[model samples]
Target: MRAADRPADLRRDLVVSGEIHYFRLDPAEWADRLDTAVRTGVTAVATYVPWLVHELPDGTFDFGQRHPHLDLVRFLDLCAERGLSVIARPGPFVMAELKNEGLGYSVLRRNPEIRAAGWDGERRPETIVDYLHPAFLAAVDTWFDAVIPLLAAHAVDRGGPIVGIQLDNEIGMLPWVTNRPDLSDRTVAEFVEGLVATTSREAVQARYGVGATSFDVTDPATWGPALRSPVDEQVLALHRDLGRFTRDRYARYVQHLRAGVRARGVGEDVALLVNIHGCWGERATMFPLGISQLHRTWADGDTIPGTDIYIGDLDLDTLPGLWTSTAFLAATCRADQPYGVLEFEVGSGDYGEALDVTTGPEAAGLKLQLAIAQGGSLVNYYLLAGGRNPELFEPVGDGNDRIAFTGERHGFAAPIRPEGDLATWFAETVHLTEAVTDAAELLRAARPERPPVTIGFVVDHYMTEYRYPGSTREAEFVAELERFRGSGPREIMTRALVVGGYAPDATLLDGPDALADLPTDRVLALAPTPSLDDDLQRALADWVRRGGRLLLSGPVPQHDMEGRPATALIDALGLDVGPTHAATPGRTPFVAPSITPDGPAWQGAEVAVGFAQPLTTRRADAGTAPLAHLARTGEPCVLDIGLGAGRVVVAAADLPCLPQIWDALLARLGAHPRIRITSDSRGVVVVPCRTPDDVEVVHVINVSPWDTAVALERDGRPVTDEPIALARRSGTWLVRRSGETRARVAYRPPRG
Candidate 1:
């Protein structure tokens, strides 16, 4: 069905959902808990229908006959009666601290072949199944066959409350580590089949030479490469291809599940939801195989792919990852679809290993604000209330004590307490819900403006798993690529951009289309690895041909994605790449340093690290113009060349490491933000979103510990003459429409 013909629920904005596990709570208290959901201004209630809970020990289905609380249809009807929408999660694998990760105990006992095998050919620590194993898929199909029809009956299109259906929960968390690849036979067969279908054996032999005949693609340890002083070309190719194949399998798994959901006859407005885990660096780096490609894997027009964001003590330092991941997810999602935070933290849960998240309305409000500012539309609070686990095991020692799965009173400091009383966060929840409702019409139609500077990125470069691991020349090159494109240019520079009061846009350099649609007036910063995708090289050449200003860092592309020499963009620019010179700390400097704190990239900056000077260069032709020179070499380190109507700025030094250099470069280009924001303090992120009707709202968030006087201006003219003093670690939204511009002063902060 066409999107326009879908139900009004699809177009209606402001979805404030709270998760309430109906099966975990008593049937008598379900009405009261649901009442709390509506009273706290929740438009919807989300619940996970565990397969283990519903399926009896005899492999027969039991929705509510045995226990009244197990009646999912009845629970959903109750939510509808209370005017609340429902997000039903019928997970064949729901990891809610349950035995077997919510899969029925008999499931694994009956079908041990479904269990995912680790890299060492051992079963995974958790009862996680290999996603594509025949046995597993069969089991899941049986489960879905039983559950989908029931969910379809309760769907909103049929006058039921179910608006969304979640396929699986954290799909790849069980074996996400590097050495934890699912090495099961079925998984290996699929991987081999995919490789044979997509890759050419002749090319593989040519690249690997004579000894490639003995290498087995089906073997896990012998799958990719054997570490050596100098890795063979065949090994490298095999490794890279393996990474691609793995990513493809993950994508196919989601695709298959989504098809399963769609085949169940779900309505157009009743969307399928897939949640991607880990919004920050630690998880992204550790599980690069899954987290890196999950966004790209679950890319579908009808499905909503959302991230799971948990703000605990470990993740406080990398809050910007939330913004980066959100931006990437939004970019990766279907155009016009609202990106959501599927599992947003409501509060800390005291079950299993305790996670202590600060419990206060201010922190909760701040997280919600940040998500919205970073372009999150649909947000589901992880839990709205706590509940007791059902009796699954018999008593062993004490008469009153039974072997409960996650302990009886699984308390999560949420809006509703275990006894059904309102928590302190109730008011905060209501406030955010009301605020989103008031601005829903405008926000639903609004899109973030392109930043003055856009960071062009290649996904493969950041996918560390694709890199051939060894001490070989190829390995060293990959290491250099990691360093060149890793920290300074990507993370630190983005932080600099944000702190400078500009909402930087991260543009994925996948193909020519992303480049063609790039803001023509803005500066495109392209800091990529030495190995570039051939298609991207062609796109870059095309982009240069059509008058697009670019900032090129690191070495010129010497190889393609397949490790073949390709210099399409380099040849077009007509540049002579020269020798490298490592800059000494506190010694190496710009030839003539002239820096002023003018632009947002340079506002109140005090950088301690030495700037990264990558290499020195000299122009190959007279078409280039020298901009700046390296002090150590006096060679042309920074130069600009005119291509067609556009100009390209090539820098030898890493622009991110040197904020002053970045500032000077921007100054030279005469590039400035369209809207200017000035603050009395630092660490405030100012994001401006404009609706289709040109209704603009600026969201100012203080990420620091101190308060600040903030002022906003468009084209150097103040929207309001007076500067407002914003509270520390708070967000103040300023909206202006039809000549009426003002701050939301009546909006209360969290009281002491």
Candidate 2:
């Protein structure tokens, strides 16, 4: 964002590194840890300097004063000495599970006002603090005053090792501050000031659909409690103002903290990154709110102070975690700059479960590589390595221990040990990092955010909480959760995208893009909740005419969120929901579907079972291609005409069609231009990083911990009827190939 004219060039130059609390490691072992990191070919090293670790509220600051452990300059000097840049995070609210680290526990216990109040007005210790509280900002400013000079003096841009400086870790501390809890008088006053600047009280009342003259503008305290519970009038009145307030809160606080960061004298161009908690992964209701935040900040304003590709936080990370979430960040980031994964599960620990999913070393490498392979220009592996906890000064949630979770205390179990010895996985990570450095350019070039294809988020699972108000656990409801059902659609479509045989730009959509008429290569069947926006429905209709291939299924949308009769676009193609009968399994292996086929119907494929008495049948206007048919089940699978430039296909049944068709269908979908590689080779992860000249650097990793070899076509050659070896363990098999080096595949040796 700083180099507005030089955005791309600036992003391309970033070399994201990993983190290990150098202080946590014994000084004796720092050398080895540093060596492992350098050997890994990492560009920068990241570490957090928690206020709790360095200062105890009374204002005394210590930088390794007495013990070598507290040594600050020595650590920065080491990074510079090692030629590794550093991402310095000095948090007054550093929430890396450090006790009293973020909002001092002592403050929470002693100053009850600092704690977030619950419904009963009792302060909750978990995440104390009013984020917008003036007192809190004042406190943060005080902390910044001391840390900034040390950092500024040693900043990488200043010929020192420090490169990027992150703003306050995660923003809001009081989600409890939502509808519950009185908006601390300080926040309410600021709220009025914000409203005054952004909206007039008269306008606010008008928007809230209330009597314009009824409310007095003198005080906002009345507004908070009155508007907390939504009235239809309030929804409209507060929608824009509410968004403005939150953004103002974010911008104000961030601006407040940044004042300290900037006042320290660090180069203005040095990036200031902040992370948005993937609040949806844990509590999905938070997504719309985050989106609103997006609408408030980056989307509209050019002058707003912030970097692009805002870092998104995720608590649950799976292979295809949430492309919607990932892509959302990409959209915001790419619009301004390149995407970045500010926080991710690199070392691997969950709410409390440590050392469970090794993800093996290959998995870790796979994510980082793919991230770069995706449009993530820079990635920060949260805990490149962990060390001793400072003490659970303010243990939130389940209380703190050595590690904060039920298991280990002291965020331990890192690639680098507390003493700094590299773990077995450490070696794999080294190899992976080396692979990335080997192919940085290509990864940047092949970023999905910049790609052409749009990854569809069918109305299925991820947003079920919002999509269908009361439908949570019912069998059919669960079946239609926006994410899960839509996942199947996304996977198949992604196949076409990857197989389309070129490095296509991939954009993810959980909300509506259909209206954008985004050139659809293919719409994967993500069975989003049978609800879609009005604009999306209209978009798909235009897209079909303009030549877009749609793969809509799972549950063909039958309504908008309010459940009005839907399927306007596909209606012409014969897509419709049948009866609401319980379409359960019958007694026979080959159950007869309710329909009789019109022609050859399918290519020797028999239908197993159809929808619960409901079938999407053709109207007189529908054109059909007999892709597949099940006689016994009487299910007629057709390829609808008007695939825009191509054709539209709908499969009312789950794929793999009786285990016999998995390979072929997968192969076909893989080759489909619209389908991208939704599967990261689950068993074997293949991440391609392109070199400077666009030469692809394929990092073939055998995530399997034990030694194993994989077969893959190399240098664009045929499969050789056998896979190319992945070699034993963390083999950093590099290959140069054509079209992404996708053909330069990856797989592990099969178990006996």
Q: What is the C-alpha RMSD of each candidate to the true structure, in Å?
A: 5.2, 7.6
Name the weakest run of 10 consecutive residues (lDDT summed) in model 2: 1-10
Per-residue CA lDDT of candidate 2, range 450-550, in tens? 23334453322332221111223232433444332433433433333332322333334534563363654444333344555555666666666666655
Estimated TM-score per prediction? Answer: 0.85, 0.71
C-alpha lDDT score of every prediction, in listed order: 0.64, 0.49
Model 2 gets an lDDT of 0.49
By TM-score, who's the top model here? 1
